[model samples]
Target: MPGPVFLRGDTVSMRTLERDDLDLLQKYRNHPEVRRLLGRVHPQNRDKVEQDFEGYMSNAVNLLACVEEDPVGFVALFDWNESSGHAELAYWVAPEHQGNGYASEAGELAVEYAFDERRCHRLDAGAHATNAASRALLEKLGFEEEGRRREHVFLDGEYVDTVLYGLLAHEWRD
Candidate 1:
């Protein structure tokens, strides 16, 4: 059977991420600028990427974002706590494709999926303090900044604070 459409926007569509996508997805994941903000801790080769992909895909609702035929990025609703109706959100677009708003569109779709389709009570997200673009995207999607963990992530030899954001289902708009 075909998979369901997890989310779709004007220019982007999201679907279940399959094993076949690992190679190209890994290329995007390895982009220095992309990994820098994603808080990647270690260098990732194909094997490492495949391993991580399997682990994540098996547990979460991860969707590959595509612009027609070309994969641009991905968005995910994971770390679910069914009892509490909560889950974490994550999204990223290829660094070269950053300016096209793919991340924002896909992220909005994921938020809708979490709140409307999944019936999640709340969704959480985090962004590095220095990543203003990502922070702005969350803000635009109706996520409110809830807190900040001072120097929470050690990356590239230094630590960076992670800004927390959350949106409650009742607070969401169509």
Candidate 2:
């Protein structure tokens, strides 16, 4: 079963990620279609996935996006710096759950938590240049495209640019 609700939205609810959801995490993390876009060129074995989960549990505000008890996606505010009040946002939806607005809703909830609940001064996100959907989603959440790193990451056998985005607490409309 999923953890208790941490943030609720119209059609999606964000819950704390749990060890029980490791299978769900692995399902999407290893899915070829999902991995490519996420820039994960290699498939993660169960042990690696477990390690990543542990890191998330220890270091990030990781949440599982669910619909009526079924996990559809994941979201997180990681790399937090309390003194600077800064953090990075990252999220991904299952391939079967893509285009249902779950990610967008979850992202809004995350941003709200960052600025209001966490008292964050700024938030940052990065997406591969080829990931138009991700870029669009970040912009839709009021994140401004601050810069692009030329050929920053090698993915799918070629180097890809990384688009950096930022949103300040004062600049947030909500």
Cα lDDT tens digits for candidate 1, 37-153: 899856779998888877766789878888875777878788999999999998888877888988888988888888888889999999999899999999999899999999999
Q: RMSD to the native, candidate 2?
A: 1.2
Q: Model 1 Cα displacement at 146 (Å)?
A: 0.9
In candidate 1, position 42 carries an lDDT of: 68
Error of 2 at 76 (Å): 1.0
User: Number of clashes in every candidate structure?
Assistant: 0, 0
Quote the lDDT for 46 in model 1: 94
lDDT of each: 0.84, 0.91
The clash tally of candidate 2 reads 0
Window of ten residues with lowest summed lDDT in model 2 = 49-58
Q: Which regions of candidate 2 deviate over 4 angstroms?
A: none
Root-mean-square deviation of Cα positions for candidate 1 versus the true structure, in angstroms:
2.3
Q: After aligning candidate 1 to the native by TM-score, how far in Å is the CA of 62 from where it should be?
A: 0.9
